[model samples]
Target: MKSKKFILESRVKDRVGFQIERILENEKPHLSQGSNFLATIGLVEPFIGLYIKYSC
Candidate 1:
């Protein structure tokens, strides 16, 4: 995950880890999808893009 993907404070980068740790410690929010979409998209999209770029 890129730092400041959610927050863009001037000095937020220094606290990114602490921010996530706080969320995990307090909010405990879950990141998920209905299927394997999130997991496979990272692999599949890049493959498709490479195939298109090199094949055509």
Candidate 2:
């Protein structure tokens, strides 16, 4: 079960990183402030998830 959870989290972090990289590369020039904020959120979300998961 722990291995499964770790795998899932790893996959999610990879996906998030990929999506943020895509957004920064493709849409950064035209992105508004709100979009930049969302991108920041994307980058931080995985850490937040891990914190919450282990804080219990």
Candidate 3:
């Protein structure tokens, strides 16, 4: 049971990491150092929101 729970959690983590990586790759060209800070927040905000909504 514990192993099953760990597997599910790891899968979710991997999926989220993949999505963030894709977002970063697509946005990299258009972002500069100054705007890069906000871009990080923008990139993660929706995922956090969705995770909260679904995890509940």
Candidate 4:
């Protein structure tokens, strides 16, 4: 079995990957830094699921 630290690190990487994907996917012309910041913080609703699902 994997160690707790390893699993936690893996989940953190996955969460970051998920967030990056979300940011890139939703980015478009005329979008502001505030919008991207919101996406990064998971405040836009859809992006929060990854954190919820992968959280320890």
Per-residue lDDT tens digits of candidate 2, residues 1-56? Answer: 99999999999999999999997888767767488799999999999999999999
lDDT of each candidate versus the true structure: 0.71, 0.92, 0.94, 0.80
TM-score of 3: 0.55
Badly placed stretches (over 4 Å) of model 4 are 28-56
Which residue runs of candidate 3 sit more than 4 Å off their true CA positions? 33-56
**What is the C-alpha RMSD, rounded to one decimal, of candidate 4?**
18.9
Report the lDDT tens digits of candidate 1 across residue range 1-56. Answer: 46666556646765887788888777533444334677788869998999999997
Model 1 misplacement above 4 A? 1-31
Estimated TM-score for each candidate:
0.37, 0.49, 0.55, 0.46
- C-alpha positional error of residue 37 in candidate 1 after TM-score superposition, expressed in Å: 0.9
Candidates in descending TM-score order: 3, 2, 4, 1
- Give the clashing residue pairs of candidate 1, or none: none
Candidate with top TM-score is 3
Q: Tens-digit lDDT track for model 4 on 1-56?
A: 56998999999999999999888878854467577777766755665776787895
